[model samples]
Target: MSLLQEADRNHLINEFQALTEPVKLVMFTQEMECQYCRETRMISEEVAELSDKISVEVYDFVRDQEIVEHYNIDKIPAIAIVRGGQKPKDYGIRFYGIPSGYEFSSLIENIMMVSRGESGLSAETKAWAANLQEPVHLQVFVTPTCPYCPQAVIMAHQLAMESEFITADMVEAIEFPQLSNKYQVHGVPRTVINESTHMEGAAPEPILLGKLQEAVA
Candidate 1:
Protein backbone atom coordinates (compact mmCIF):
# COMPACT_ATOMS: atom_id res chain seq x y z
CA MET A 1 0.00 0.00 0.00
CA SER A 2 1.25 3.45 -0.88
CA LEU A 3 1.53 5.89 1.96
CA LEU A 4 0.57 8.84 -0.20
CA GLN A 5 -2.66 9.17 -2.09
CA GLU A 6 -2.54 9.46 -5.88
CA ALA A 7 -3.61 13.10 -5.80
CA ASP A 8 -0.98 13.96 -3.24
CA ARG A 9 1.66 12.14 -5.25
CA ASN A 10 0.79 14.06 -8.40
CA HIS A 11 0.85 17.33 -6.55
CA LEU A 12 4.26 16.58 -5.09
CA ILE A 13 5.57 15.63 -8.51
CA ASN A 14 4.55 19.00 -9.84
CA GLU A 15 5.94 20.79 -6.82
CA PHE A 16 9.29 19.00 -6.94
CA GLN A 17 9.60 19.67 -10.65
CA ALA A 18 10.58 23.23 -9.76
CA LEU A 19 13.75 22.12 -8.01
CA THR A 20 16.75 24.06 -9.26
CA GLU A 21 19.18 21.66 -7.61
CA PRO A 22 19.17 18.18 -6.23
CA VAL A 23 18.20 17.38 -2.64
CA LYS A 24 18.95 14.27 -0.60
CA LEU A 25 16.87 12.88 2.21
CA VAL A 26 19.07 10.91 4.57
CA MET A 27 17.15 8.62 6.89
CA PHE A 28 18.43 6.60 9.84
CA THR A 29 16.66 3.59 11.26
CA GLN A 30 17.33 0.39 13.16
CA GLU A 31 15.65 -2.94 12.45
CA MET A 32 14.43 -3.75 15.94
CA GLU A 33 12.50 -1.91 18.62
CA CYS A 34 11.78 1.06 16.41
CA GLN A 35 8.09 1.86 15.96
CA TYR A 36 8.05 4.05 12.87
CA CYS A 37 11.47 3.46 11.31
CA ARG A 38 10.12 1.46 8.42
CA GLU A 39 7.34 3.90 7.69
CA THR A 40 9.76 6.79 7.82
CA ARG A 41 12.07 5.18 5.28
CA MET A 42 9.10 4.30 3.11
CA ILE A 43 7.86 7.88 3.13
CA SER A 44 11.31 9.17 2.18
CA GLU A 45 11.47 6.71 -0.68
CA GLU A 46 8.00 7.60 -1.83
CA VAL A 47 8.73 11.30 -1.84
CA ALA A 48 12.00 10.79 -3.68
CA GLU A 49 10.12 9.04 -6.43
CA LEU A 50 8.33 12.29 -7.25
CA SER A 51 11.30 14.14 -8.66
CA ASP A 52 14.44 13.21 -10.55
CA LYS A 53 16.38 15.72 -8.49
CA ILE A 54 15.38 14.12 -5.21
CA SER A 55 16.93 10.99 -3.73
CA VAL A 56 16.65 9.01 -0.53
CA GLU A 57 19.33 7.18 1.42
CA VAL A 58 18.42 4.81 4.18
CA TYR A 59 20.94 3.65 6.79
CA ASP A 60 20.91 1.46 9.84
CA PHE A 61 21.61 3.55 12.90
CA VAL A 62 23.52 0.74 14.60
CA ARG A 63 25.66 -0.49 11.69
CA ASP A 64 26.50 2.85 10.15
CA GLN A 65 28.26 4.19 13.21
CA GLU A 66 30.60 6.50 11.30
CA ILE A 67 27.86 7.96 9.14
CA VAL A 68 25.68 8.26 12.23
CA GLU A 69 28.36 10.28 14.00
CA HIS A 70 28.98 12.35 10.90
CA TYR A 71 25.35 13.40 10.69
CA ASN A 72 24.98 13.53 14.49
CA ILE A 73 21.86 11.39 14.39
CA ASP A 74 20.89 10.47 17.96
CA LYS A 75 17.58 8.72 17.45
CA ILE A 76 15.74 6.26 15.31
CA PRO A 77 13.40 7.41 12.52
CA ALA A 78 15.48 10.52 12.04
CA ILE A 79 15.85 12.45 8.78
CA ALA A 80 18.53 14.87 7.62
CA ILE A 81 17.85 17.01 4.57
CA VAL A 82 21.00 17.83 2.63
CA ARG A 83 21.83 19.33 -0.71
CA GLY A 84 22.57 16.62 -3.23
CA GLY A 85 25.91 16.45 -5.06
CA GLN A 86 29.33 14.91 -4.62
CA LYS A 87 29.45 16.73 -1.29
CA PRO A 88 26.52 16.84 1.12
CA LYS A 89 25.39 20.33 2.16
CA ASP A 90 24.24 19.86 5.74
CA TYR A 91 21.95 22.70 6.70
CA GLY A 92 21.32 21.13 10.13
CA ILE A 93 17.62 20.58 9.30
CA ARG A 94 16.10 17.51 10.81
CA PHE A 95 12.84 15.67 11.49
CA TYR A 96 12.85 13.40 14.52
CA GLY A 97 9.78 11.33 13.64
CA ILE A 98 7.48 10.38 10.79
CA PRO A 99 6.50 13.64 9.11
CA SER A 100 2.84 12.83 8.78
CA GLY A 101 -0.12 15.25 8.71
CA TYR A 102 0.83 18.92 8.83
CA GLU A 103 4.53 18.10 9.08
CA PHE A 104 4.42 16.57 5.59
CA SER A 105 4.07 20.07 4.18
CA SER A 106 7.06 21.18 6.25
CA LEU A 107 9.17 18.41 4.69
CA ILE A 108 8.27 19.61 1.20
CA GLU A 109 9.01 23.23 2.04
CA ASN A 110 12.39 22.28 3.48
CA ILE A 111 13.31 20.36 0.34
CA MET A 112 12.53 23.40 -1.76
CA MET A 113 14.47 25.66 0.60
CA VAL A 114 17.60 23.50 0.38
CA SER A 115 17.32 22.96 -3.38
CA ARG A 116 17.23 26.69 -3.98
CA GLY A 117 19.98 27.31 -1.41
CA GLU A 118 17.80 30.03 0.04
CA SER A 119 16.33 30.45 3.49
CA GLY A 120 13.60 32.92 2.41
CA LEU A 121 14.12 34.88 5.61
CA SER A 122 13.89 38.64 5.92
CA ALA A 123 17.14 40.64 5.80
CA GLU A 124 16.80 41.54 9.47
CA THR A 125 16.29 37.94 10.57
CA LYS A 126 19.08 36.81 8.27
CA ALA A 127 21.42 39.32 9.84
CA TRP A 128 20.55 38.11 13.30
CA ALA A 129 21.21 34.48 12.40
CA ALA A 130 24.46 35.31 10.60
CA ASN A 131 25.99 37.13 13.58
CA LEU A 132 25.25 34.45 16.17
CA GLN A 133 28.36 33.72 18.22
CA GLU A 134 26.89 30.85 20.20
CA PRO A 135 25.26 27.64 19.10
CA VAL A 136 21.48 27.43 19.24
CA HIS A 137 19.31 24.33 19.16
CA LEU A 138 15.58 24.47 18.43
CA GLN A 139 13.27 21.59 19.07
CA VAL A 140 9.68 22.09 18.00
CA PHE A 141 7.33 19.59 19.59
CA VAL A 142 4.19 18.75 17.61
CA THR A 143 1.58 16.12 17.16
CA PRO A 144 0.74 14.84 13.69
CA THR A 145 -2.74 16.28 13.87
CA CYS A 146 -1.84 19.85 14.77
CA PRO A 147 -2.68 22.30 11.98
CA TYR A 148 -0.45 25.03 13.36
CA CYS A 149 2.64 22.93 13.99
CA PRO A 150 4.09 23.23 10.51
CA GLN A 151 4.50 26.98 10.86
CA ALA A 152 6.65 26.51 13.94
CA VAL A 153 8.68 23.78 12.25
CA ILE A 154 9.27 25.78 9.07
CA MET A 155 10.31 28.89 10.95
CA ALA A 156 12.94 27.02 12.94
CA HIS A 157 14.17 25.33 9.77
CA GLN A 158 14.54 28.66 8.01
CA LEU A 159 16.73 29.89 10.84
CA ALA A 160 18.78 26.70 10.65
CA MET A 161 19.27 27.20 6.95
CA GLU A 162 20.34 30.78 7.48
CA SER A 163 22.87 30.11 10.24
CA GLU A 164 25.50 27.44 10.70
CA PHE A 165 25.31 27.87 14.45
CA ILE A 166 21.65 26.83 14.46
CA THR A 167 20.24 23.31 14.39
CA ALA A 168 16.48 22.86 14.19
CA ASP A 169 14.48 19.72 14.73
CA MET A 170 10.79 18.94 14.37
CA VAL A 171 9.99 16.43 17.04
CA GLU A 172 6.70 14.49 16.80
CA ALA A 173 5.49 14.66 20.35
CA ILE A 174 3.32 11.57 20.09
CA GLU A 175 6.06 9.47 18.55
CA PHE A 176 8.64 10.49 21.13
CA PRO A 177 6.78 10.47 24.41
CA GLN A 178 9.84 10.60 26.62
CA LEU A 179 11.09 13.77 24.97
CA SER A 180 7.64 15.35 25.17
CA ASN A 181 7.51 14.49 28.86
CA LYS A 182 10.99 15.81 29.55
CA TYR A 183 10.22 19.06 27.80
CA GLN A 184 6.76 19.36 29.35
CA VAL A 185 5.14 19.62 25.95
CA HIS A 186 1.49 19.64 27.02
CA GLY A 187 0.34 21.64 24.03
CA VAL A 188 0.89 21.61 20.30
CA PRO A 189 3.43 23.78 18.50
CA ARG A 190 5.65 24.16 21.54
CA THR A 191 9.06 25.38 20.45
CA VAL A 192 11.91 24.92 22.90
CA ILE A 193 15.01 26.97 22.16
CA ASN A 194 18.36 25.79 23.51
CA GLU A 195 16.41 23.62 25.98
CA SER A 196 15.68 26.68 28.10
CA THR A 197 13.67 29.32 26.27
CA HIS A 198 10.21 28.05 25.41
CA MET A 199 7.51 29.43 23.19
CA GLU A 200 3.99 28.12 23.60
CA GLY A 201 2.42 28.53 20.16
CA ALA A 202 3.07 29.21 16.50
CA ALA A 203 4.89 32.49 16.67
CA PRO A 204 5.63 34.84 13.80
CA GLU A 205 9.16 35.28 12.45
CA PRO A 206 9.85 38.42 14.47
CA ILE A 207 8.61 36.85 17.68
CA LEU A 208 10.57 33.68 17.03
CA LEU A 209 13.67 35.76 16.40
CA GLY A 210 13.08 37.53 19.67
CA LYS A 211 12.87 34.18 21.44
CA LEU A 212 16.13 33.14 19.80
CA GLN A 213 17.77 36.31 20.99
CA GLU A 214 16.49 35.62 24.49
CA ALA A 215 17.92 32.09 24.35
CA VAL A 216 21.40 33.31 23.50
CA ALA A 217 21.29 36.25 25.88
Candidate 2:
Protein backbone atom coordinates (compact mmCIF):
# COMPACT_ATOMS: atom_id res chain seq x y z
CA MET A 1 0.00 0.00 0.00
CA SER A 2 1.18 3.50 -0.82
CA LEU A 3 1.61 5.84 2.10
CA LEU A 4 0.64 8.92 0.11
CA GLN A 5 -2.64 9.23 -1.77
CA GLU A 6 -2.64 9.72 -5.54
CA ALA A 7 -3.71 13.34 -5.22
CA ASP A 8 -0.98 14.01 -2.69
CA ARG A 9 1.59 12.36 -4.94
CA ASN A 10 0.64 14.58 -7.86
CA HIS A 11 0.84 17.68 -5.70
CA LEU A 12 4.25 16.64 -4.38
CA ILE A 13 5.54 15.97 -7.89
CA ASN A 14 4.53 19.46 -8.90
CA GLU A 15 6.18 20.90 -5.82
CA PHE A 16 9.38 18.98 -6.42
CA GLN A 17 9.54 20.24 -10.01
CA ALA A 18 11.06 23.44 -8.64
CA LEU A 19 14.16 21.68 -7.37
CA THR A 20 17.31 22.79 -9.13
CA GLU A 21 19.73 20.95 -6.88
CA PRO A 22 19.78 17.38 -5.66
CA VAL A 23 18.50 16.53 -2.17
CA LYS A 24 19.27 13.34 -0.27
CA LEU A 25 17.16 11.95 2.53
CA VAL A 26 19.30 9.78 4.81
CA MET A 27 17.26 7.47 7.02
CA PHE A 28 18.49 5.26 9.89
CA THR A 29 16.62 2.27 11.22
CA GLN A 30 17.25 -1.05 12.92
CA GLU A 31 15.48 -4.30 12.07
CA MET A 32 14.35 -5.27 15.56
CA GLU A 33 12.58 -3.59 18.45
CA CYS A 34 12.00 -0.39 16.55
CA GLN A 35 8.43 0.69 15.97
CA TYR A 36 7.67 2.79 12.90
CA CYS A 37 11.19 2.32 11.57
CA ARG A 38 9.95 0.51 8.49
CA GLU A 39 7.22 3.01 7.86
CA THR A 40 9.67 5.87 8.11
CA ARG A 41 11.91 4.39 5.47
CA MET A 42 8.90 3.57 3.31
CA ILE A 43 7.63 7.13 3.36
CA SER A 44 11.08 8.50 2.52
CA GLU A 45 11.36 6.16 -0.43
CA GLU A 46 7.88 7.01 -1.58
CA VAL A 47 8.67 10.70 -1.48
CA ALA A 48 11.92 10.14 -3.33
CA GLU A 49 9.96 8.55 -6.16
CA LEU A 50 8.25 11.89 -6.81
CA SER A 51 11.29 13.78 -8.06
CA ASP A 52 14.33 12.88 -10.08
CA LYS A 53 16.45 15.23 -7.99
CA ILE A 54 15.46 13.55 -4.74
CA SER A 55 16.94 10.29 -3.44
CA VAL A 56 16.64 8.18 -0.29
CA GLU A 57 19.30 6.20 1.52
CA VAL A 58 18.34 3.74 4.23
CA TYR A 59 20.92 2.64 6.83
CA ASP A 60 20.79 0.23 9.74
CA PHE A 61 21.11 2.16 12.97
CA VAL A 62 23.04 -0.65 14.71
CA ARG A 63 25.35 -1.66 11.88
CA ASP A 64 26.07 1.74 10.38
CA GLN A 65 27.82 3.14 13.45
CA GLU A 66 30.30 5.21 11.48
CA ILE A 67 27.67 6.73 9.23
CA VAL A 68 25.37 7.35 12.19
CA GLU A 69 28.14 9.08 14.08
CA HIS A 70 29.05 11.11 11.04
CA TYR A 71 25.52 12.41 10.79
CA ASN A 72 25.17 12.77 14.60
CA ILE A 73 22.04 10.64 14.61
CA ASP A 74 21.28 9.19 18.04
CA LYS A 75 17.94 7.54 17.54
CA ILE A 76 16.04 5.09 15.37
CA PRO A 77 13.75 6.27 12.58
CA ALA A 78 15.89 9.36 12.11
CA ILE A 79 16.29 11.39 8.93
CA ALA A 80 19.00 13.77 7.79
CA ILE A 81 18.55 16.05 4.81
CA VAL A 82 21.72 16.74 2.87
CA ARG A 83 22.28 18.90 -0.19
CA GLY A 84 24.14 16.90 -2.84
CA GLY A 85 27.32 18.52 -4.15
CA GLN A 86 31.09 18.25 -4.17
CA LYS A 87 31.36 19.97 -0.82
CA PRO A 88 30.01 18.72 2.51
CA LYS A 89 26.57 20.20 3.07
CA ASP A 90 24.48 19.07 6.07
CA TYR A 91 22.31 21.85 7.43
CA GLY A 92 21.72 19.83 10.64
CA ILE A 93 18.06 19.42 9.77
CA ARG A 94 16.53 16.23 11.16
CA PHE A 95 13.33 14.41 11.98
CA TYR A 96 13.36 12.00 14.91
CA GLY A 97 10.16 10.14 14.13
CA ILE A 98 7.66 9.31 11.41
CA PRO A 99 6.63 12.65 9.94
CA SER A 100 2.94 11.90 9.61
CA GLY A 101 -0.04 14.26 9.72
CA TYR A 102 0.87 17.96 9.86
CA GLU A 103 4.55 17.09 10.18
CA PHE A 104 4.48 15.71 6.62
CA SER A 105 4.30 19.24 5.27
CA SER A 106 7.45 20.07 7.20
CA LEU A 107 9.32 17.30 5.45
CA ILE A 108 8.36 18.71 2.04
CA GLU A 109 9.33 22.22 3.07
CA ASN A 110 12.66 20.97 4.30
CA ILE A 111 13.36 19.30 0.94
CA MET A 112 12.68 22.59 -0.84
CA MET A 113 14.86 24.49 1.60
CA VAL A 114 17.72 22.05 1.17
CA SER A 115 17.38 22.12 -2.63
CA ARG A 116 17.42 25.94 -2.73
CA GLY A 117 20.11 26.23 -0.02
CA GLU A 118 18.08 28.90 1.71
CA SER A 119 16.69 29.04 5.23
CA GLY A 120 13.65 31.14 4.33
CA LEU A 121 13.99 33.01 7.60
CA SER A 122 13.45 36.64 8.41
CA ALA A 123 16.43 38.99 8.31
CA GLU A 124 16.40 39.38 12.09
CA THR A 125 16.28 35.65 12.73
CA LYS A 126 18.91 34.94 10.12
CA ALA A 127 21.22 37.56 11.60
CA TRP A 128 20.78 36.07 15.06
CA ALA A 129 21.45 32.51 13.91
CA ALA A 130 24.52 33.56 11.89
CA ASN A 131 26.11 35.23 14.92
CA LEU A 132 25.63 32.33 17.30
CA GLN A 133 28.85 31.32 19.05
CA GLU A 134 27.51 28.33 20.95
CA PRO A 135 25.80 25.15 19.88
CA VAL A 136 22.03 24.78 20.32
CA HIS A 137 19.84 21.70 20.08
CA LEU A 138 16.13 22.16 19.51
CA GLN A 139 13.72 19.26 20.09
CA VAL A 140 10.15 20.03 19.21
CA PHE A 141 7.73 17.53 20.73
CA VAL A 142 4.53 17.00 18.79
CA THR A 143 1.76 14.50 18.24
CA PRO A 144 0.67 13.47 14.75
CA THR A 145 -2.71 15.13 15.09
CA CYS A 146 -1.70 18.59 16.27
CA PRO A 147 -2.44 21.21 13.66
CA TYR A 148 -0.26 23.86 15.26
CA CYS A 149 2.79 21.67 15.77
CA PRO A 150 4.12 22.16 12.25
CA GLN A 151 4.68 25.85 12.82
CA ALA A 152 6.87 25.15 15.83
CA VAL A 153 8.74 22.38 14.05
CA ILE A 154 9.30 24.48 10.90
CA MET A 155 10.55 27.46 12.85
CA ALA A 156 13.19 25.44 14.64
CA HIS A 157 14.16 23.80 11.37
CA GLN A 158 14.55 27.20 9.73
CA LEU A 159 16.88 28.24 12.51
CA ALA A 160 18.91 25.10 11.97
CA MET A 161 19.00 25.80 8.24
CA GLU A 162 20.36 29.29 8.93
CA SER A 163 22.99 28.29 11.50
CA GLU A 164 25.47 25.48 11.21
CA PHE A 165 25.77 25.19 14.96
CA ILE A 166 22.07 24.62 15.50
CA THR A 167 20.53 21.15 15.20
CA ALA A 168 16.77 20.92 15.08
CA ASP A 169 14.60 17.79 15.40
CA MET A 170 10.90 17.18 15.19
CA VAL A 171 10.11 14.51 17.78
CA GLU A 172 6.75 12.79 17.56
CA ALA A 173 5.72 12.63 21.18
CA ILE A 174 3.36 9.69 20.78
CA GLU A 175 5.92 7.54 19.02
CA PHE A 176 8.43 7.94 21.84
CA PRO A 177 6.63 7.85 25.11
CA GLN A 178 9.74 7.53 27.24
CA LEU A 179 11.24 10.62 25.69
CA SER A 180 8.00 12.50 26.13
CA ASN A 181 7.96 11.56 29.81
CA LYS A 182 11.63 12.41 30.23
CA TYR A 183 10.95 15.86 28.89
CA GLN A 184 7.66 16.09 30.82
CA VAL A 185 5.75 16.93 27.70
CA HIS A 186 2.10 17.23 28.61
CA GLY A 187 1.04 19.29 25.65
CA VAL A 188 1.65 19.63 21.94
CA PRO A 189 4.10 22.03 20.26
CA ARG A 190 6.45 21.89 23.21
CA THR A 191 9.86 23.03 22.04
CA VAL A 192 12.77 22.15 24.27
CA ILE A 193 15.83 24.29 23.63
CA ASN A 194 19.19 22.92 24.71
CA GLU A 195 17.32 20.66 27.15
CA SER A 196 16.74 23.56 29.50
CA THR A 197 14.49 26.25 28.12
CA HIS A 198 10.98 25.09 27.23
CA MET A 199 8.40 26.90 25.13
CA GLU A 200 4.89 25.51 25.10
CA GLY A 201 2.69 26.13 22.05
CA ALA A 202 3.38 27.54 18.60
CA ALA A 203 5.85 30.38 19.06
CA PRO A 204 6.66 33.00 16.46
CA GLU A 205 10.11 33.51 15.05
CA PRO A 206 11.06 36.37 17.37
CA ILE A 207 9.89 34.53 20.45
CA LEU A 208 11.74 31.41 19.41
CA LEU A 209 14.84 33.50 18.68
CA GLY A 210 14.56 35.08 22.11
CA LYS A 211 14.43 31.64 23.68
CA LEU A 212 17.44 30.60 21.66
CA GLN A 213 19.31 33.64 22.86
CA GLU A 214 18.39 32.81 26.43
CA ALA A 215 19.62 29.25 26.03
CA VAL A 216 23.07 30.44 25.00
CA ALA A 217 23.17 33.26 27.49
Stretches of candidate 2 off by over 4 Å are none
lDDT of each: 0.92, 0.90
TM-score of each: 0.97, 0.97
1-217 per-residue lDDT for model 2 (tens digits): 9989999999999989999889999999987838889888989999999999998989999998999999999887999988875654888999999998889998998999889888788999898888988899999999889999999988888888888899999999988899999999999999999989999999878888888888899
lDDT of 2 at 31: 71
Per-residue CA lDDT of model 1 for 1-217, tens digit only, reads 9999999999988988789989999999986738988888889999999999999998899999999999999987999999998666899999999998889999999999999999989999999998998999999999899999999999999999988899999999998999999999899899999989999999889999888888898
Clash pairs detected, candidate 2: none
Clash number for every model? 0, 0
Give the Å error, residue 157, model 1.
0.3
